[model samples]
Target: MAVSLKRTPLYQEHLSLGARMVPFAGWEMPLQYTGIIEEHHAVRREAGLFDISHMARIFVTGPAAFDLLQRTVTRDLSRVEIGQSAYALACNEEGGILDDLYVYHSGPEEYVVIGNAANRDRDFGWLAAQKRAGEPVEVIDRSDELGMVAFQGPKAPALLQSIVETDILSIPRHGCGYVDILGYRCFIGRTGYTGEDGFEVLVPVEGAVALWRRILNLDVRPCGLGARDTLRLEAALMLYGNDIDLTTNPYEAGLGWVVNLDKGPFIGRDVLAAIKARGASRRLVCFEMFERGDIARPGYPIYHDGREVGRVTSGGPSPTLGKNIGMGYVPVDLAVVGTRLDIKIRDRFGPAQVVRRPFYRSPSLGG
Candidate 1:
């Protein structure tokens, strides 16, 4: 017998909104409410809300919490200030990425690690196994007990400010703070996956539907996983399973900036150090079709000079740019901007060219 898929706290809310539910990471999630392109433009132009409760919220506490995390991720946790968040990657001993997550320093000796929905169990198990025989650190999985929602776009702050009593605009990028929303305590973070200015709100599972309904009353577009994927793709954000996996390393995925080799020892530090010294043979790059009508898709072969050089990892028609865009891995020498290539689609090859990172950038990002 097949195991039943999980449902988030807001599953009913999604159904009420006429969302087309589909299986994603072992859960029945909304693929689209209105439509992919319509929802995608809603986030880019105005504001949109997403049911992100599928993400894992794991908590670590005790005197040795910091030390345990220092040994588990690639970024240096010592530099992260209280109430601040940083993106980091957990890797295996061989330096292959296990998952990329956000770490928030909530308080002294208290931290929250938000892992990808699909990697929750594995991430929690990895952390639990690292507790030295009698260490004080505690790894607790709180994903099912809590709910998360993301409000994104240029007008997100204004919409959020109207609901909460806290001065949310005061929170800087990558910062987290506590606030009261309709009498419910919420953990709000100034971060998002859509490459826009937004906040990810975490609250008790019981309060999820209330919060979702309140946001819906504000005229915020209710987006689904389809738009979320497209928005992140146009932003050049790496997806865990597709863009990076056990066979891929941070250096080759264009995530070298997050690796801190000088911060002392951590999981995969030695191998990453060696890889950085030797240089990566291939790198992740963004590209766009030179001719219309040819769309790139995952697993499609990329060619240069009549030879297969790489394969597309994520690709789709960008609603914001109104063009076909995709990301893939290619030889380092041919990854430069302006380099022309071909993508095999069905019976013919379509012309494409390397472009700068991020096919779209919202004007509301820097403010």
Candidate 2:
């Protein structure tokens, strides 16, 4: 029997826009509306709206909320004050990445974790299982009750500010606060995966459609996951299952900065510290195709020194840069910029060169 895929509250709105829906992480989501390139350029040059309600929103509350987070996440939550959010990782006992998530210090002794859509069940299960005996913490999955949307791009701030009551600019990067959106108090965070100034709003499921429609009225182009992937790739942001997973560690995945061994005991602290001391054998690096008419996709073989060393984890054409880019794991020595790599394309090999992460940056940032 085929299981029914879930749909977001904004599903109707997506359909109304003539979006092409596809199955993603067990959710029927928009793959594209106008076109991937058009939507991708809309975000880079202007603004784009995304329905990200499929991602899991889990809440940890009560007296032990902070304590439980400290024990489960890789980052030192002690430094995260109320109204601020931090990007962190959940690791198993072996120091393998369970998921990369954002932790929002929503209130006093209350935290909300936003995890990948595909890992919703597993992430909630792992967090719930960590509640100590007699511990007052409650790990609650509110994914079904809440809906999330991302308004991302250079112009996302001003456009979102026009609809919300709270001062959007006052919300620091990686910060969150309750704001009125379409007459409802929604949690808004100034964080995004597109390497641009953007705001993600967590609203009650009832208000999601209204809020989405309101943003669309402001001329924000409705973008699907296709554009989302290309935008994130230009920024060199790693997708969960592709770039990192149970078999991958943070250090090798170019995410060592999120791990804090000195933060005291956590799930994988001991193993991670040992791995840190010894160094990682492989590394995840971003590369760009040197030739036209060739693109690297996930699982494509990567070669160096005339031998197959690894495979592409994530790859696609970057509309913003007008180039084909990809990310893949390779020997540490071969991960440096300017290193030439060969990506197996069908029966032939295509040339690519290792480049700096983030192929695109806003001019306002002064790169």
Candidate 3:
């Protein structure tokens, strides 16, 4: 018998928008609303909204919360004060990535860990098991009780600021705080998967629809997984399963910046430290198709010279860049910018060149 799929609070809201539904990570999610390319451009030019309730929402609380998380993820928690969030990686003993986590220091002795949707059970179980016999910590899974939404794009701040009385723009990058969204108290973090200035809000399931509808009425286009993928790909942001997984390490995946070796010991610290002391053999690189209309897909073979050197992890047409771009793991020697390579598209090799990591950057990124 087939198992039943889960639905988010916005499931009916998505249907009302005539979204194309598809199965994703055991959840019935919207793949597209109008069109992938159209939605992608809408986010780049103005604003777009997404129901990200499928992602896992977990809370680690108690006096030992900080200590527990400190010994688990790669990012140092010393700098992450209350109202700030940080991107981190949890790894197994062998240094393989367990999951990429977004940790928010919500309050004193309290933290909210956002894990990948598919790894919710495993992540929670593993984290709870990591607590020592006397550790004062409680791991609570709130995925079913809460829903997530992402309002992304250049106009995201101004549009969101118009709704709530609080000044949303005051929150710096990676900062988070609770705000009243249409009178619903919700926690929002100034971070996003797409390389755009946006916020990810966590709200109670009961209030999700009201907030979603209110945002839609503000003229923000409802986006789907298709546009989300293309947007992140254009930014070269690594997707947990596609770009980084159990077989890939942080350094090899161009995520060395998130790893802090000078901090206290953590899970997989020794192995990761040793790897850093030496060097990673392979690195993830972004490449663009040399020919027009040649979109690369995941699992496609990458060739240097006449031999297959790597496999594409995440790839597709970058609507913002108006080109086909992809990311794959290749030897360090061949991952340099401007390196020419070929991607095996079905039966033929398509010419490609390793360009910079992000194929597109929002004009509002730095300034």
Task: Assess each prediction's global lDDT (C-alpha) against the native.
Answer: 0.92, 0.92, 0.92
Each model's total of backbone clashes: 0, 0, 0
lDDT of 3 by residue, 1-367 (tens): 8978899999999998999999999999999999999999888888899999999888999999999999999999988999999999999998999999999998888999999899999899878988999999999999999989999989998899988897889999899988988777899999998888989999999999999998889988999999999999988888988999999999999999999988989999999999998999999999999877687999999999999999999998888777889999999999899999999999899999999867888886872
Residue-wise C-alpha lDDT for candidate 1, range 192-260, written one tens digit per residue: 999899999999998999998998899999999999999999999989999999999999999998899
Q: Once superposed on the true structure, which residue ranges of model 1 sit more than 4 Å away at CA?
A: 1-3
Q: Model 2, range 224-244, lDDT digits (tens) per residue?
A: 999999988888887999999
The pairs that clash in candidate 1 are: none
> What is model 2's C-alpha RMSD?
1.0
Model 1 per-residue lDDT at 77: 89
lDDT of candidate 1 vs native?
0.92
TM-score of 2: 0.98
TM-score of each: 0.98, 0.98, 0.98
Task: Report each candidate's C-alpha RMSD, comma-separated, in the order given.
Answer: 1.1, 1.0, 1.0
The residue pairs that clash in candidate 2, if any, are none
